[model samples]
Target: MMAGLLGNNVITQIGILVHDIDKVSQAYADFFGVPKPEARWTDAADKAQTEYNGEPSEARAKLAFIDMGSLQLELIEPDLHPSTWRNYLDEHGEGPHHIAFFIEGMKEKVTLLETNGFPLQQKGEYTGGRYAYMDTFKELKVLVELLENDK
Candidate 1:
């Protein structure tokens, strides 16, 4: 059997960049009639190991997650630092960011994407998983994120 380059096309989350995560999170919650999830900041640079354009960066973002069925919606408000989130927000104001997928072999998937013209943008670790953002906006019309949770 054959598989797609990145293995599968299952989208797990959709990220949105906003000016204020707290306000946006509340708006989304009120619109959906659900409790507003608390917004929190990402780990520090040292802990998250955040990198932007192949260099270490002190980029951080306030984030909140809202589950909608099997898919999740992520709200991001980036700080004044160099990162994919910050760049996109600066260039395009505020709106949708990326669609995310959960993948197993993060290294291999990132390499495959890079080889296929989707360069890795920013990457960092969270509490239970790590994530990679790929520069697929030109071709795919939006960025793509790969999430790898520790087993």
Candidate 2:
């Protein structure tokens, strides 16, 4: 098997699952001395449903986009439903959920990881990019995501 492609060539967004959107967003804003982030919701996301491990459910999340220097920080609060953010909060409190890496070959990279014994924990795509989660934490304890630059 070919070695998986992993590199820090791109600086992507960092997603944090928060219990309180206002408080968490404020903390970052104050710390960075940046203005408060704008809160937004996605109707497409609200209407979108996903199948997780064979269970079908809606994926609705409130989002706040904050500019941190050159990088953007996305703070997500899942509505009163079980979602990926909710699951992460339940397991690891409110903190960093995933780190997205910008790459050229997303499908090929995902296949490489899957074929090399890394089963997908979750996979989804938004208007901006696509993402996947691999259950290879013992060796690589971070959520890996490949994002296409939408500029």
Candidate 3:
């Protein structure tokens, strides 16, 4: 079997959308005995060339990550900014939001996906590299994210 996104790992993180990030992260850590996840807040994601529903967004989200053996569990609480987080919350009411793959050659991958007809939903640039969320819910029944961190 082929490992997808073969850079650091395949499907490295599963992102969950929630109303309260700290609450859920604490609950998971306390109840499940998992290590507490590192929490951080993202910027407005404007410079990442973010577009929500085909428009620029000033969206921000609180993110937390718990490191599993190979995979990771991410918790995201969308701030009151224009983002897919709000859309997922409004439509699905807090659940598995997206599966992220850590990879290299981000622009190539994004362009490849776009060539295959998976239009980009949102993208943002962080300290290292960049990331993008693809709109695949219609066919795959879930959103997909691509991350390139080792810039």
Question: Which prediction has the highest TM-score against the true structure?
Answer: 1
Query: After best superposition, candidate 2 residue 1: deviation in angstroms?
Result: 19
How do the residues 1-151 of candidate 1 rate in per-residue lDDT, one tens digit apiece? Answer: 4257767688899999999888899999999999999999999999999999999999999999999999999999999998999999999989999999888899999999999999999999999999999999998888999999999
lDDT of 2 by residue, 1-64 (tens): 3233644545477788898888888988899898888777644434343534436656567889
**Residue 138 shift from truth in candidate 1, angstroms:** 0.4
Q: What TM-score fits each model? A: 0.97, 0.78, 0.86
- Candidate 2 deviant stretches above 4 angstroms: 1-8, 43-51, 54-56, 149-151
Clashing pairs in 2: none
The lDDT per prediction is 0.94, 0.69, 0.82
**By TM-score, highest first, what's the ranking?**
1, 3, 2
Error of 2 at 4 (Å): 5.5
Higher lDDT: candidate 2 or 3?
3
Measured on C-alpha atoms, candidate 1 has an lDDT of 0.94
List candidate 1 stretches off by more than 4 Å. 1-3
Q: Return model 3's CA RMSD, one decimal.
A: 2.6
Global Cα RMSD, each model:
1.0, 3.4, 2.6
Candidate 2 vs. truth: CA RMSD? Answer: 3.4
Considering every candidate listed, which one attains the maximal lDDT? 1
| Candidate 3 ranges beyond 4 A from true positions | 1-9, 46-49
